[model samples]
Target: MVVDRASSTRIVPRDPVTAFGIGNVATTGPTTVRAEQQVSTDLVDHRGRIDLPALAVLFDHLGGLPYFASDPDGSPCVQARLAISMQGGVDVGDRLTANAELLMHDEAFGTTRVDIVTSTGRICSSGTARNVAVGRTFDHNPTGDRGAAAPPGNSDLPGLPLPPAIEPGLDGRVIIEQIAAGTRAAGNLTELLNGRVDTVDHPLGTGVRFTVGTEPWMGNVFGTMHGGIIAAAVAQGCSFAGQANAAAGRDYQVADLAICFLRSPAVQGADVVVEVTPVKIGRRVASFDAAMHAHDGTLLSRCSADVHYR
Candidate 1:
């Protein structure tokens, strides 16, 4: 499902972020987009379920399409806020489809909703994104050739090397320890984006800081860190931090996550630091606050998430 940009007057450049994160997508109308992919080993977490960061990438990709499609000038829009809630579960080998619709829009901003459903009609996840026009316009014909090269295929994108496999049924804390000790990988999505759990401290109960290296594959069409990747880093930080603070013999899951993009981080091989701080740690539920910063200390994004104990 290559993007059907033929009818449009603009040529959106192909970037590695879209190539790797969004695989294949199609636009049904000016206000809707659809994408499909199969759950593979690289898309699953240690528990063999789809990872939240992977869902964030898909949400960001499809959720921005409606805004792009409705704008006649093809002006670029950056996501101002993104929120997602996981309702169901999906695992490896499941086929998934995402449908996105434009919920509302005005001159300066637009809101879009996307729902990811499995083959059995289960709603795996649902999310909404708010995007604001950046006040910049693209060339009517940037390539000067309407018949420009097509988007890159899978072969053209960089492959995510599988991390060292971990033993099955390991609890979250054990996995975190293994990751910290360099004994196990930090799952597929983290490895794909060069994310690392750098430090785990017990200050104020528990605090976790992770770093994601700025690689070319993590850049958006504008050459900055993709909003989805930023959200992914935040999700990773919060999840690990929550695990570090969870009670023994108990497990937790992210119930909801919201992210606000304050600024974009340049993809210059520097590390984006994500610091996770606990807001409240309850027996039934927990809340966390995460902040992402550039290597030079410039704040990039802020996120909040809720985790439910099980």
Candidate 2:
């Protein structure tokens, strides 16, 4: 996802969301735009709930429409841009709630802005983005239709790294790799479990399906799966989705996230599963919604997330 006239870069995970370099990550397709309610993803396996920070990305992914290629003829010629202003987020499970709305469009600039609200409806994050037309390819000059002019070159963009004044902690570092790439291999997830869990298969967009036994070390002061463990799973699921839509040779960044807790997951003898669905896919921004459920069909938690694709 090259935005404006920026050079290509990679993405890295910071804390909760995955980001593409500092601004953009390549995507599999174009932005998916709509104001419809869709099933998006399943967040059933998360223990208890996800944190506010992690959940916001889930929402952003869902809000964006799934990207698809169009026929060379008859499709409208237009530039699409997606921007998000994140309101505050709530802490449910280990994740938060991120609220945002799409802003207006500018034909000349080929971009749009959005308003992001928190669960409590507070403004937490906001930014604007610019998008220009990137023309399509065709054979024989395309008999029925014509293509937009190619975007101007962006060969002079500068490197914008994270503020040098800050550094990342160990957990934060692990989160970067986990989310920058897709879900860890089943063996990796099992290694993280230290042999205390078993994984199952549930394809068809269901992200992660696994079972964990109640172990004393896995318990928190609240007598359930520890928040860290739950957060880890949620991060893995969201990260996997990020990788799925990610363009090769770039990293994804999480811009915002929101999560809702439906129920407490049992720490002992219970299993959990995860599912992911995308919401929006802007040139520089991306979003998704996910769910975690127990084996018995209890909705343990729901999450939304937003990311800046680099």
Best by lDDT: 1
The TM-scores of all predictions, comma-separated, are 0.82, 0.37
Tens digit per residue, CA lDDT, model 2, 1-310: 1223243332222211122111111122343222111111112112211122233233333222122122223222221222333343323211222222223323223333323334354554444333332243323221111112221122332222221221223232233244234332222232233222222123322233333433433443334443334544554566555545555444555555444444546566566666656676555766777677777888776767765665
Q: What are the per-residue Cα lDDT tens digits for candidate 1 across 135-244?
A: 65444421122213333433443333445555445555667777777777677656656678855555466778888888765666676877877887788788787777
Query: Quick one: best TM-score, which candidate?
Result: 1
lDDT of each: 0.71, 0.36
What's the distance in Å from true for residue 172, model 1?
A: 4.7
Candidate 1 residue-wise lDDT at 89: 64
For candidate 1, the per-residue lDDT at 145 reads 25
For candidate 1, what's the RMSD?
7.1
| Colliding pairs, model 1 | none
> Deviation in angstroms for 68 in model 2?
49
Query: In model 1, which runs have C-alpha deviations exceeding 4 angstroms?
Result: 1-21, 137-174
